[model samples]
Target: MALSQTGIRRWYLVHKWTSLICTAFLLLLCVTGLPLIFHHEIEELTGAHSSIEQVAGGGTASLDTMVEDAKRRAPAQVPGFLFWDSEKPLVAVVTASSLTDQQNIVIHYYDARSGAHVPAPPHDEGVMAFLLDLHKSLLMGLPGTLFLGLIGLIFAVAVVSGVVVYAPFMRKLAFGTVRKDRSPRVRSLDTHNMVGIVTLGWVMVVGLTGLILTMATPIALIWQIDELSEISAPYEGKPPPTRLASLDTAVAAARAAAPGGQKLSSVAWPGTMFSSKHHYMIAFSGETPLTERLIHPAFVDAETGRLTEIRDMPWYVKGLFLSVPLHFGDYGGMPLKIIWALLDIAAIVVLWTGLRLWFGRRRVPIEKRVEELRGGGVPEPAE
Candidate 1:
């Protein structure tokens, strides 16, 4: 729908300020996010990732052995979670001084079949990990994550408002036209509009997905307070199990509790935030990419090794899951990753050109700016 001149002017200001506010952060995100799209592939190429040796019988060793190996590796730390690597036949145990301690955690990897320690680089110590931290949270943890989410929200507004104001300007020009004969600033403005519009869908997807990811901490908290509390109601006032059941028995019970096709992905040990005090939380994933992101959880009694219950994640948590694959373009494999990279590069161009135009725009009244949008007044040459 077409907007009036007054509406266009309002939107132009919205676009202008929102862009100015988020362009720097958004640019940082785009730059850092580019490499992250190929995070797995990059890790594999660098030899930082370990390959799993397949056993002749195609049998995976018991989870108990893996946990023992991990404990031996990090004797001082307690096991927090045990998870399988999605792309390889490797299992990892995440250990820390305490379940709640988020710092100095260590990940111990083992060959799923042989149950031998696989020496791989620490997950938190690497260039890609550094870029990922900066991209996701600026190394400030939840606060930085939430801050970037707000920036994403502002970026969405900027994109929408940019489209709103661009409509009036484009009414007279062909779609995707960049006028070289015009002054430098005009040419840049045209290029910026063209590129922004072309990559509009992709930018919105990445931006909104990123915003959702930032809410992970809060979403987990809500789940714990709401659904988890309900799940734990039966065992109210019960202390965490003193002598836990066998890891293998708990895993077996959890597997039986889950559906036919879902495979075990991870297990949160009892007393961890992700698990109940009286139960071991086991998460399962589907075979396909999209399904893998959507987790299905099952609870096993920590002491008895008996199945407690299996349930699907809440809708909001599922939304968070769906956003992961969509945000990274990892679900569709190599082709999608390449396409995502190209769009990211184009977004960088759009941001760069927009910044240039802002810096070069003439000092003019609101009326003059509105006139420029109306495609009547000529913007002054790049200053």
Candidate 2:
């Protein structure tokens, strides 16, 4: 199949502009995201959280007891949520925010059995944290994330246009072939094309999924309007309770009222974004591969310790949740992680070669360039 002259020119324009706009950020994304693939490994090797040790005897403590213990450790903070760690059975993490400032939240670790404060790993305070922040938000927070998302959008366009160009480029040659004996310009072009083809599937998946990740905040906000507003509507005007029921009791009631096969695993206390100011938001994540991606929010009266409403999660919210593990290659075991690393390296090469080919292109008549583009490429002597 042959691409028309007009189509070739149009797609070239699209590829050129989009690639120019997103190449730099995409390079940064590749470089920083590389370490993130091995983030946990690096953290463990550096002993970032080594100071936090499992309590002897490996016993579990009551969530109610740990909440008070965490408050004693951070007296000025208000407990917001409690999460269980799968890797460390004897550890529970308590996220508490400032009494005066909502934005200031401190994370505290407690021995799950004894309810004693456990020092957080140094990694939480050091380089890994910095790397994660830099990769995700560029240290500029929401604006940075949104900006990266926009760049990702451009990257997607560039990928599509490049694909359009590739079909025409490969029409005259074997797929993935590189002309090593040709001039530097020819070789560079070939390298770019070959690497791009090899990694096309990966960059597409990573790029598209990466783009979805950048919209995480906006997606959550959408859920808030569609799910949160509707579920918490009845209690909209009610004041937050000063005395809430015990978390253990709340959990028990949530479980008792939950539908068959749905178990409440996490809870968001009153006065937090995950819950209404007047109710506890208990979350039930499914055990199945897909269902586990989204949380079904269960609302319970903070003062009464009784479940009021439990609604299924919206698809968009589930999509957001599912994207996380896939984007990071977290679902499968070590084999999949290795495959992710390999593809990541290939993507970096494609980015670099593409950048070089674009910038180093010879300055010639637009018609001549378009003609060269119309075919797979021009001869080395043509330039």
Candidate 3:
């Protein structure tokens, strides 16, 4: 059945407004995301000194030594978190204030061998930070982040409506047909629908993933407030151990408590919440696709280093983890990433073409005319 002219016009209006509202923000995100997709490769090629692997010995370095070294470098600051880059064998002691007044800081590049502070190499902060900021709210902070998320939601709706309208638009024409000899508007509309529909699957996946990413913070907060608090309720008001427990012991405890098939790699500390106050948060990995990617965190008692719970992740948390690889195009290797990049480029072209079509339409609405100034002639639409 053919769509009436009115139906076609309504769909056109839907496409126009939806695309316009989200286009600028979506364009910025896609552009920034493109570079970030290759950040690791770019960083490697740039020869930036991000690791202390050459200097690190095989065994774990004493946290006390690393902490001392860090404090010596910045006496006025208190250590916030100690990050061990397992792959790089580098330890970073992060420092920040309890209050948000001061900008949180990380003094990176400490040589594990000499325990000496090393200067980080200069590269393109402009490009890297710009891309990151654009991806995470256009440097507009929380409000900007929320706005982009809303835009992403609209983008998803647009994708769906686009597919709906595509069927009707293509009903009279064969697949892959391009009406080069038709009216300019028809030709543009045909091009738009063809390109847009062809990339539907890819764009929809990316858009949905983007929406999930936007909700990450709120989801995490809910988990922390509800589940985590309940899980840790027994330990409430108990003083943390005066002696810092051995990370090795916590890791061992976590491994034993986790399902026999899995491997436990690292433990997050209490106050860190990545680690709970009462227990170490052990990250588990498995051999299978679903299991390997899913993180099964076991909460152990902080004072005793005894494992309390080993359980399956909540659906929302699982969704959050799964969404990351899909959104980043990292689950598949370089070939898939290349496909993702191409699809992203195609999205940009669609946005640009849509903008052009909109402006072209605006120039000469059939019912509207530009007023002529004194003795000045009115401009006419292109023949």
Candidate 4:
């Protein structure tokens, strides 16, 4: 059903306000996130990362050496998380929590093939890290995180309202039509509407998924409070195990418990917030394209190295995992990244033109603005 003039006006207000509220944050996201898309490549070019050369025999290195070296490098620190780069499995990053400072953690990288210490990638203080933190939380911690999430929500509203009003505005214009030979206001309006409509689906998906990504903390809390609590119920309130079982043994037990074709993703040691005081929480990823986001957690007894429980991730947890990489547009190969970049640029243009039209309409009467939406007649700028 076609929208009435009153309906169009209502949606126009929705589109305008929502877009205005979130456009600034969205612009920052686009700028910071653009470099993030090519972060890996940038790392290689800047010597932050090195190309991994395969060993002669395709032999796997012992995880024990990597862990031992990591501990040796940070003797005062306790082991926390251990993970390998999916793209460069030959490199392992082991995190060690500081002994004196709870907030500080040391990250050590190792060549999985030879157990040699590799220079860790740029982290908290580096350029990429700065951009990453700004993109993630705007340097404001939880409040910043939640605020960006709100922006994402507003962007979603803007997308919906824009799409709704696009039909009425474009009723008389051809698809992808940009009125170049028109007033500045009309041209800006055409650019805004055209680019917005062209990138509608991509923008909506990215925006909504980005919104979900910002809720990661809450979703993780849910998992910890729900499924994780159930799994660790037997060990609740138990003191930290002083004489813990070997991490290698615990990992092996976890691997045995996990299904075939799943790869270990990361491990959270006992006493960590994400793990029970008496259990080492091990996470694994599926081998297939789709199931990769569905984490299968394996809980192993810290003292006995016994597999306690193995369970599939809940939907929200899966959604968080999926939303993260999807929002970054880094999951797919280079071609997909290029496409994402171009669509991102298109979205920026849409935002710019929208702002132009909005500012241009300040001096014009509201009636003329409504008529402008109904049919493209150039409106003069007030200044």
Candidate of highest TM-score: 1
TM-score of each: 0.95, 0.90, 0.81, 0.91
Model 4, which residues run further than 4 Å from truth?
Answer: 55-60, 91-103, 376-383
Error of 1 at 113 (Å): 0.6
lDDT of 1 by residue, 130-249 (tens): 999999999998899999989988998999899888888877778888887877777888899899998888888888988999999899889999888888899888777889899999
In model 3, state the lDDT of residue 201.
Answer: 80
Q: For model 3, which pairs clash?
A: 278-302, 279-300
- Every model: Cα RMSD to truth: 2.0, 2.9, 6.6, 2.6
lDDT, residue 119, candidate 1:
82
Ranking by lDDT: 1, 4, 2, 3
Worst 10 residues of 1 by lDDT: 48-57
Better of 1 and 4 by TM-score: 1
Which of the numbered candidates is closest to the native, going by highest lDDT?
1
Model 4, CA-based lDDT: 0.78
| Model 3 Cα lDDT, one tens digit per residue, 1-383 | 35555565566567667888988888888889998787666665543244344543434545556666766766666554554443454556665453121245545445544555656543325567567777978787767777888999888877776675666555546776666666565466567767888887888888887888888778877777867887788877987666555655666777787777775444455666455566666677675656666878887776776778877778988897788777888656688888888888988877777777677775556332111111111223354
TM-score, cand. 2 vs. native: 0.90
Local error of candidate 2 at 139, Å? 0.8
Off by over 4 Å in 3: 1-8, 46-93, 99-103, 107-126, 239-243, 260-266, 273-275, 287-292, 363-383
User: Local error of candidate 1 at 126, Å?
Assistant: 1.6
